[model samples]
Target: MKTTAIGYSENLPAAHPEALLSREVPVPEPGPRDLLVEVEAVSVNPVDVKLRAGAPADGFRVLGFDAAGTVRAVGAEATLFAPGDEVFYAGSIGRPGTNQRLHLVDERIVGRKPTALSFADAAALPLTAITAWEALFDRLRLEEDSAGTLLVIGATGGVGSVMLQLAEALLPDVAVIATASDDARAARMRELGAEHVVNHREDLVAQVLEIAPEGVDRLFTAHSEGQIERYAEIVRPFGHVVAIDDGPRDVSPLKGRSISWHWELMFTRPLLETPDMIEQHRLLDAVADLVDRGRIRSTAATVLGPISPAALREAHELVERGRTVGKVVVHGWEEAIDSARESTDIY
Candidate 1:
C-alpha cells in the first residue's frame, strides 16, 4: 500500500509554488517496537521550517514531527498499543517524519491520545509538550515543591504556551514570570497562569527584577541567541538556565555566578534509542490525564484546514514568521487531492 505526502525536493522559500508538493510514496513497514499509524492530523513547528529550508536535492525530506493518529498495525515487539489505539507522538528525528498518511513510530515514544481533545488539538501538544516537559523537569531539575522564581522567555510560542500551562499546574508553589511583546499575548500568558508578564522588546532584566527583587531562580529561554548576558544578570547566582534553540555564544558570563546552561531536544531519546526512551510515553500519558482533568488546555489557536500541500505551506509560512501565538494545526487529509496527485516520489 502507498500513502500521499507533501515534500520539497530542494530548498526554497515558502511563497514559492514548488516549496511543498504532494506525491505518492510506499508506506513503510513497521520495525520491531514500531506502530503503523493512519495519520489524522499534524502541527507545524520551527524545526519543520528549519529542516525544510535545508532539504537536500538528493531526496525528498518530509518535515512534520507532531501527529495524532490511529494505529493500523503493530510490530512484533510493540505490545504497548493495539491496532485500533488512538495515539499522539513526536516522531524520532533520525527517521522519516510524520507528514505522510501512514507513519511508523516507535511505540515507546507514543502515547494514548487524550480522550478529551480532538485530533487537531492533540496534535499540537506532542512536540511542544515533550520539549517543554523535558526542558523544565529533566534539564532544569525543578520539582513540584520547589520554591523559586522562573522567567519564561518567548512565552507565547507553541512550546512556551504549553510550558506555561505545565509550569502553572505542576509547579504551583513556584513563581512564573513570562515574557510577551504585546498586551494580548500578555493576557494570554496570564490566563495560562503566569504570575507576571513582561514585554520582551524592552529591558528584560529591569522588568524581571521588578517581580523578583533579587533574581529568578531559573530561566527557560526559547530565544537563547545573544541573550546570555541578560540571562546572567536576571538569573540568580547558582541558578540554572535551559534553552531549546542553538547559536554561537560565549559562556564566560555564566561561569562567574556558577549558572549552568542546559539544552533540550525531544528527539534525543529515540535518536539514540536510549534506555529511557519510554519516558516520553509516560510523560505524554500524564499530559493526557492533565488535559482530561482540566488542568491543561490545547494550544492550537490556528487551524489551517486539511492536510494538503497548500494548507501545509501556509502553516509553514505562519511558523517561519515567528509571530504565531500558539500551535497551528492542519487536520485530516483530502482524499480527492491525495488520489489525484501524480508527482513522482523519489525516495
Candidate 2:
C-alpha cells in the first residue's frame, strides 16, 4: 500500500526544505465506488498555498485539488470507470489530495480526460472549470436567455480565465466586461472573449459604467477580500453577485440595491456527498466536449516540470505571491526531480 507522495508536516515558508517533504505513505484501500488512479499531472491552486501556510498537520498533509490520471483499479461498486481509463478530477476536500502517485477518488466526481489535451493540460481545467460552471449556472443562474452585462472583477487568474470563456461559449449574447491590471492582461482578456476589458487598478465603477451605462447585471469575483464594496457599486439594482474566495462578506452595502451575494465552492458537492455530486462528472465531461470541439482552452499557463517537493514548493511560492497569470502545474513523476535540488528535492 506504500506509494510516493509529497507533503508538509509543518507550516513553513516555501523556501524552507521542509515545506514539502517526500515520503512513503500508506495508500488507503479503495472504498466502494472509488477509483484508484496513478496520477499523471497536477495543478496548483490558492487553496494549496493557504492550507500549507496555515493548516496544521499531524504527520504530513498532502494538499492538491486538480489532477489528471489513469485508473489503475476500481472498487467493487465502481462502474463509472475501469482500469486504464484516462480521467481528470478535482478531488473531495474530505479525502487525501491528488499530490501522490496513487490517489483514491469517487467515480461520481471524476470525468473522462479530454482526449485533445495532454495530462498536464487536462489537469488545469477540472477545478477552475467546475468553479466557473457552478458559479455561472448554479449560483448566478446565468441561463441562455439571461441577458445583461456580466462583469468579472479579477479576470486574469485561473478561475477568471475559464469564466470568460464559459460566458462567451454559453451566453453568446451577453456582454462581458473583464477587469485586468496591465496591458498584457487586458489583451489576454480580449483574446479569451471579453467584450470589454477594463483596468482593475483604476476606478472599476467608472470603467465598467462606460461600457454598461446602468450597471453590470452580474459580477464574479475570484478574490473577494476588499472587493465587496466595489461589487455593491458596479452591480445593477436587484442584480446577482457570485464570489469564489473565502473571507468576511459584509453585504450591508449591497442591501440598498437588493443585490444578492452568493458564494461558490467547487468542492461543495463532493465534500457533502450531495445527491447531485454526479454533476461534477457531467460538467467536466461537458467541458471536455467543449475542449475537443475547440470552444474553450486550458488555463495552465505555467508548468513547473515534475511532481516533486522542489517543483511543488516553487509552484506554491508562485501562487502565494498572488501574481500567477494562470494555473501552475507539474507533470510526470520523473527521477530527475529528486536529484535536482540536493537537500530540498523530494520525489
Clashes of each: 0, 0
lDDT of 2 by residue, 130-184 (tens): 9999999999888887788898878898888999999888998889989899999
Report the C-alpha lDDT of model 1 over 1-347, residue by residue, as the tens digit: 77887888989998788998888999898998999999999999999998888857367877789999999999998899999999999998888888889999999999999999999999999999999999989998889898888899989888888999999889999999999999988999999989999999998889999898788999998888888888889989999998888843787789989998888889999999999999999999999999999999999989876798899999999999887888999998887345546433422
What's the TM-score of each model vs. the native? 0.95, 0.95
- Residue 100 of model 2: what lDDT? 94
* Residue 103, model 1, lDDT: 92
Question: What lDDT does each candidate get?
Answer: 0.90, 0.90
Clashing pairs in 2: none
